[model samples]
Target: MTTTTSQATGSSAASDGRGARPDRRRRGKEGPAVAAVPVVPAPKLRRRPVLVAASVAAVCLGALLGVWTWSSTSNTHEVVALRQDVTRGETITQGDLVTVQVGLDPALKTIPGDRLSSLVGQRAAMDMAAGSLVTAAGVTKAVLPSEGMSVVGVALPPSLMPGERLLAGDLVRIVATPGQQGDLGQEPPATVAATVVGIYPNGENGETVVSLEVPEGQAAELAARAATGKVALVLDSRER
Candidate 1:
């Protein structure tokens, strides 16, 4: 009985020793309990070289366009402009012109403000409105009523002239009509070629006073016919 007890004790001791060694070995092999670290998926390395370059290029282009627009709009010029309304054939005085800053087109013809002094005493070739830009073709230096030409004023009712509006520089003919007695055997009507110079409306008498430029020799005859009020106006073709 003693020996059996001894054997049983020895076996139990051996079993316990084997189990403790295995547990110690496992603990040593596995390090301290590691804390779970969240893995942030390595920041997705999506490289878009084309897209990045395009974005950069777009920003640069926008800046360049803005600068170009500013430069274009800031370009300005000092030019001459009319300060008041001026009728055809009227002389341009200092008071009639002003210097102005403007952005002018390349194709536009403008008289520079520096030439303002030169424009004095020059005649306007056509009717010019207030605030209009003075151009090279707007003024003339030619002596009006050329040496052989004489200006005559003729007043006529609407019935004796064409319905079309008459403007300065129009070519016209003044024709004499028979007197109220109506002479049947009278010679052909007399006609005088003339150029329109100025037109004035006579509101009180319902007549238009037209200033005409005619040959010096014919001026007296045209004046005589016009005084009798038996003449009509014929507008000639204005082409060229």
Candidate 2:
């Protein structure tokens, strides 16, 4: 009975020792338990190239605005401008002139404001409208009927004149046709070159009275020819 009891006790001790060895081996093989950590994704990379492009565009626009503002405010001058419409050969009076401040372009020639006084009494070389800048090519002292010239009025029907409308400063010639006295026939009918100085409607005959500026030597002859109602006005291609 004692030996049987001792063998049972030894068997129980061997079973306990085997269980303790397996537990110690498992503990050594596994690492210590650690608390679970929450995972966070990294922030997406910033769009650096897009940001740089926007900044450059803003800077360029600012620079352009600054340049335009500077140009508009810089380098201006005072010059002469016409205050009224002056027809060719019409005299310029004080009421016809005005001064304006403008930025002068190197390619455009302009008359100075100080010359406004000198422009008075001079005739316009061509038709100039209001708000036009007065230049050296605008006015001249050469009158339409200058020095030794005389103006003669001729009554002419529209059909006997050129098709184009005639104004002052037009170059024209009077061609004599069959007069009331007799036939001018051939002989190329005497031609006299003249410049138009004035024009007006004559009565209600649909005829126009044109004032021709001709030399004093030929004024009487042309007037006599026009009185016959056989004179025609020829417009020359010369422009003012």
* Top candidate by lDDT: 1
Q: What is the C-alpha RMSD of each candidate to the true structure, in Å?
A: 8.5, 9.5
lDDT tens readout by residue for model 1, 34-101: 88999887677898999999999999999999999888779878999999988777668899999999
Go through the candidates in order and give each one's C-alpha lDDT: 0.90, 0.88
Best by TM-score: 1
lDDT over C-alpha atoms for residue 158 of model 1: 97
TM-scores, all models, native as reference: 0.67, 0.59
In angstroms, give how far residue 150 of model 1 lies from its true place.
1.1
Clashes of each: 0, 0
